[model samples]
Target: MEYYEVLENFGQLALACVLGGMIGYERQSRRKSAGLRTNILVCLGSCLIMMMSYEIYKQVEGMTNADPARLGAQVVSGIGFLGAGAIMKEGVSVTGLTTAACLWVVACVGLAVGAGFYIEAIMTTILVVIVVGVLSHFELKKSTRAGVLQLTVYSDNNPEQLSIITSCLDDLHIDITKIKMREEYARNEREQTIILVMEMMLLNSRHYSTTHIVNILQDLPGIHGIELR
Candidate 1:
């Protein structure tokens, strides 16, 4: 290869590093298994393979039928194994799927850079960052806002009290997953008291703290005490 051609190829490789590193930085910031170094290596390797394929085709010219795409095509299929490694099943939820997808996309971006499709590679990197970085932020915010709560409410033996408590919970978008109630006689008081134990899930718990819930229930006519776990 001529000196200028080799310099151009090196330039392409450098671009691949930059594009891959952009994605890697996001993954690293989030503490993903495949972080900055892994993504950059994957992109750099794929780019080198594509460049080698092209060089091989040039050397053999018309000797036999040497296809530049043959080696590059293997990258697409071979990347699946690496992607699969990123996936994990934890209990009922599966994680790292997005990381696996990011690896695959990063490899493609590398191939584009190797093939001199600079615009395509840059654009793909931007879109992938938006999908994994920006979109993931919103997804995590929504998910973390939900939480489970266990509450024990002490109130007078009034049927209307239970109704009032549930009404308040409903207004706050709290779902009662499980509930138990029992009647008990107070040591100092002659009237019967109701002990309500409930397991609740909040759709947006961040909006309502445990103290806030307790304060709301304390204002009810029959409620005497509240405990939250």
Candidate 2:
């Protein structure tokens, strides 16, 4: 490549870094796991990979035609594994999914820059900023205060009832992290009573209160008592 062309693509790489940071800034503000630095590096790294790939496929004076897109395709495929590592499941809720998605897209932007598709790179950066930064807040608001509640109720002479209650919790997306049940008798009068102790965590991290959880538990049948701790 000529001096000027090389300079121009280098500049593209720089821009990709800035754009990646712009997208990552929003995630950092929202306390996401992958913050500004992580995103910026992802974008810049992708750009470098793409640029290297392009250079590799270039048919020089001694070499014949080579497929450049081959390298770019591999770049994307490689990024997929990295993105998958960022995704995780917590009980009934999933986290890092959006962050992982952003990372993957940032890689694409880098590849675009390497391929000299400056316009597409810039546009994609802006769109990512809007979607990951702006739209995430709204999505959080919509899901806030909305979650599945787990409940455990105790009853005497009906141990099978506990299974039914747990089943209902599952249907509502309320997964139990721990469960302990005991049978006790008072005054030796065959006062066998079931004692249920359980723990619950909302899959969605939103603005919620214990009362909201309590109310949901109250609505469940056979849940005479509920405790969230």
Candidate 3:
């Protein structure tokens, strides 16, 4: 490659680093699993692959049928596996989907940089940052309004008590995401008590409030206390 060509490639790589790092920093600040280094590597690798593809096409130019996009197309499809690794399932809640998507988009941005689409790459980076950073606050606010309820319930060690609580939640149309139970011996009362911690989300159609949940549960027999978080 000519000296000028080498410098151009270097510039593209540097731009990829900056653009990818912008998104990565946001993810890192949010404590996401795919952050900083991961994003940078994905972007830089994709950029290099695209550049190689272009160079190969140039070298083989009239000698054979060469597609500069062939390698980039592979990168687009192959990146899915890396993105899939970022996703996680916990109980009924799935997390890291956004991180996975971020990885995929960052790879595309890198390809754009490598293809000399500097304007497009920079614009994409800005839009992605806004979506993941500024727009996330709105998403959070909406989620808070929708209400994911965490409740700690203390009750006598009776299976029926647990059943009743679950049934009540079902009746209220609460979508229970997770439940954890542990038995503890009450030193003073000389009886075994069950501590149930529940994480649930209230359906949008349901109008039940936290206070209503507490009141309903408190009236149930064998229930000692209910705490909401």
Candidate 4:
């Protein structure tokens, strides 16, 4: 427990906090739930645990039972629970996976700092920031290939059917951009029919075809015909 040793350990903790905060800053700027304070605390706590493990190893010198890396191994696997907390499922769309992953990596960065792997820790922080910041736009652009789907539906004027259709669209992760409804009088049946035109943004359009959506809507009661434009 020399003064220099204490300084070194303190410096490592500081580095871990800084690196973790940088990653969290990116997430915070994007309005993510787990941001600055959360990341910093996780990193600092991990670093402290690792530092204690290292000190224990030094104290138990010449002992065959000591393992300096044992605590760090636990940190690696134990971080999963924290990461899982960051994930959220909304309808068919899942969010916060990237944030969870970032937290996991930040934990690793903290361990690296505690182990005196400064270079590796710094490099990993930079890479995480680049992936989270720069690559996200490209990923969004790539998924927009399917773009928007425009559809017109002919059905009976039933509010229940309309509710079912909207619910199905939400489950499909389809965002309704615009919707227009007009009433039509059927000459043969004397019943009122509804004509609905909708513009929707498909989240996973590659997996869902126009025909697939039409088939799904056809199953709902009161839907007579569906036309994809």
Candidate 5:
């Protein structure tokens, strides 16, 4: 009701908008599904709800039953719906987890601002920006160094090809995690086939070329066919 109090409330809302906008800007730059306006609305809505909670508390200040934080607390769990909307699942890869997290944290930042926890809100905003902008690329580069390798080799049931394959991987310092082998036979064809499903950790080193590995495997005696997936 008071002019100063109105200014204070608007200030919190403005801070929430600015902080949420920063997060949304980063996601927008990355072309994410939940960007800009979505995040700003989420933060602004949360801040408004928090301010309403405080107002309700003031109205019931003389009553012993008043709990200012009761309404604001719901915002924490209620934000999950928005967070879930930002997430996506695709086969083996799940994307948009970070975007979902950003939404959740921005909501928290908004609540903090509305509740007059300015320091916490500002620090959280800075950290969110750093995580979204800087650490994301670092994690991506690290992920490129690790993967699974599925290899199927056709040989004359001889162990030589297997030996060369293991030797090549060992020399290249590649880590072998798990391997499964199964034998397949064609009724119309005379030669039997050995199918190898190997899970390997690939290093992003110059010496490790998949093409070179395939060529070396092909050169082995009695190797009828080679496939890598």
Candidate 6:
């Protein structure tokens, strides 16, 4: 390798490291999973891979059969698995989607820096820090008002009570997406105790707490029992 080429490659590696550190620091300060060391290693690894590819390209006068975008594109697709691993679903609530997205962005930043797109990498890193570290709190605050409610009702004597209950829920402006009964058993009888389960998607879901709903149903004419899960 020529002396100047070696120096230029070293400069690319150094700058990639420094920029990665800057972004990682911001995320680490917030105690994110993909913090300093993780980002640093990613940046270093991408730099090495690109440097190798650049050398191969140089050998062919920048006319190699191998594509420059090959490795970078793979990095993006592979990073999706990491992002999916980060996201978690728990009983009508999902978490870590944004964190997972941040991790993906980190990989992109590393690739950009490795490919000598310093300005774009640095700008994207700053935006990512702001998006993940700064904006997350507000998004969380906004989401505090969001919640999900599940309900099941049993009635024995009054068959018409089903309409009443549904109407009441409608009056409350609650959105009901699905209503199913006899899903657990083969029998459907009007005189027999019937189960009514409501699957609802709600926003600003604080208006009716599950406990509060239970309390309200206690005195209703035909209510047998209520379950929330």
Root-mean-square deviation (CA) per prediction:
9.9, 6.8, 4.5, 8.2, 7.2, 7.2
lDDT (Cα) of model 4: 0.81
Better of 2 and 5 by lDDT: 5
Q: Any idea how many clashes model 3 has?
A: 0
Q: Which residues of candidate 5, in runs, are more than 4 Å off? A: 140-207, 212-229
- Give the TM-score comparing model 5 with the true structure, all chains together: 0.68
For residue 161, give model 2's deviation from the true position in Å.
Answer: 9.6
Instruction: For residue 136, give model 5's deviation from the true position in Å.
Output: 1.9
Off by over 4 Å in 6: 62-64, 140-229
Clashes of each: 0, 0, 0, 0, 0, 0
In model 5, the clashing pairs are: none
For candidate 5, write residues 1-229 as lDDT tens digits. Answer: 7999889988999999998899999999999998999889888988988889998998889898889888878998999987898787642235688898898898888888888998999899999999889997886676565544456666665545456666777776664443444455644267544543323334434455677766776786666677775
Sort by lDDT, best first.
Answer: 3, 1, 4, 5, 2, 6
Candidate 4 ranges with C-alpha deviation above 4 Å: 144-229
What's model 3's lDDT at 55? 87
Candidate 2 on 15-73: residue-level lDDT in tens?
Answer: 88888888889889988888899888988988888887777776442465567777778
Question: How do the predictions measure up, each by TM-score?
Answer: 0.64, 0.67, 0.76, 0.68, 0.68, 0.61
Q: What is the per-residue lDDT of model 1 for residues 1-229, given as tens digits with 9 covering 90 to 100?
A: 5999979988999999999999999999999999999999999999999989988998899967789988889998999999999998642236788999999999999999998899999999999999998997886676565765677777877767677987988888876544566666565467544454333334545567878877987898877677775
Model 1 bad stretches (over 4 Å): 144-229
Q: Write the per-residue lDDT of candidate 6 for residues 37-71, one digit (tens) a residue.
A: 77777777776776676666667664546677777
lDDT of 2 at 140: 63
lDDT of 4 at 32: 95
Worst 10 residues of 2 by lDDT: 148-157
What do the candidate models score in CA lDDT, each in turn? 0.83, 0.70, 0.83, 0.81, 0.76, 0.68
Residue pairs with backbone overlap in model 6:
none
